[model samples]
Target: MLLNNKEHLNVSEYVDLNLELRNLDLEEKKKLIWPVSKSVDALMNFWNSEPVRSRQGYNDKSECSQLCLGQLCPALYTIMSDGLKPHLGSTFGPIANSVWQVVEASSQQGPLTKTLNDLVQKINGEDFITEGMLKFHAFVFGLLNLRALDAWFAYLCTRESILRKHYNDSSVLTRGRPDEPRPPLPRYPLIE
Candidate 1:
């Protein structure tokens, strides 16, 4: 099913599917084996496609220019045309999309599964929106208890979501002067 730029799911229907998925054992979940085969098929294509380079209507200020995906429509997305969405981009997208397709394909799944899959992939693989990139998807899974994160984290547990450790420039503040010591500031706010 085609998903609108903005879409939603029925929580009631999804709850049942969640139970079905819950019934699956570790081995089954590892293989991404869900009752919904069609959903898996569609998700394969969704993860590979890139973000909308140009919106259907011709407008530079359209979603094409916004940094984020349409989630923050009027907020103006700073993401590059080729850049990935934060949080769920490169890594999380494919993983998240896999789960989305499963949930959506179920009898209890929602119609917006396709849209959710695409958006999740965009957030993970393309932009690398994990906490490292200061994206919301990172916290979405961490802070919130959305059922969506299940498949993503499941994938993480099975295949092993690998994080390459690379030492780069320090984000810590550097002393401008080599010899001069930095002045100490009060840790607490001063009373008026």
Candidate 2:
């Protein structure tokens, strides 16, 4: 689990990283300069390995949180990832991507820009990066697909921590989608 602020100063690191992202506005961010689509395809491919039944929540389960965090959430994510069947993929893609976008924008819980407005000065923080992932990993990624969204929420909560740690914060949200080619919501997490 990622240590709390006690582990190190979080502000400074966030400042550095914010600079990198802020340099690029929403339109730029949408470009996917890093070629995110291919990586997304790979992740979807992995989820496609299982059948919808297997990819769906366990028959013997209740409580959305438990069902979601447990097996149900993962199942739907996988099933949705399976190539868009005309009756399935095509119908769901737009809805799914839009829902994700809403979650991405709303999850912030606040204005992130204001929070990190003076990033450079915030560098007064003193902290070191530890080796390992944060505790919210499964809860976050498993709950939502690891997209710019993953980065958005993480950045919102622990801007400094994410910047200090190595690895792409693809979890953050970005703008400019391809006509919102995601599936409808009832299929993803809300249903199961």
Q: What is the lDDT of candidate 1?
A: 0.32
Q: How would you encode candidate 1's per-residue C-alpha lDDT over 40-153 as one tens digit per residue?
A: 344344434554444355453443223223332111111111112122335534333222222222212246344445544555564554433243333233322344544543
The sequence of per-residue lDDT tens digits that candidate 2 reaches over residues 1-192 is 233534542455545545655566544544433334544444455456555356555442333344334543344333222222222124445233322222233333446443222221132131431211211223344334433434544453443332222112232321222332333322222211
Clashes per candidate (backbone, < 3 Å): 20, 20
Q: Report every candidate's CA lDDT.
A: 0.32, 0.35
Badly placed stretches (over 4 Å) of model 2 are 1-35, 49-136, 144-192
Per-candidate TM-scores read 0.18, 0.21
So what's the TM-score on candidate 1? 0.18
Error of 2 at 38 (Å): 2.4
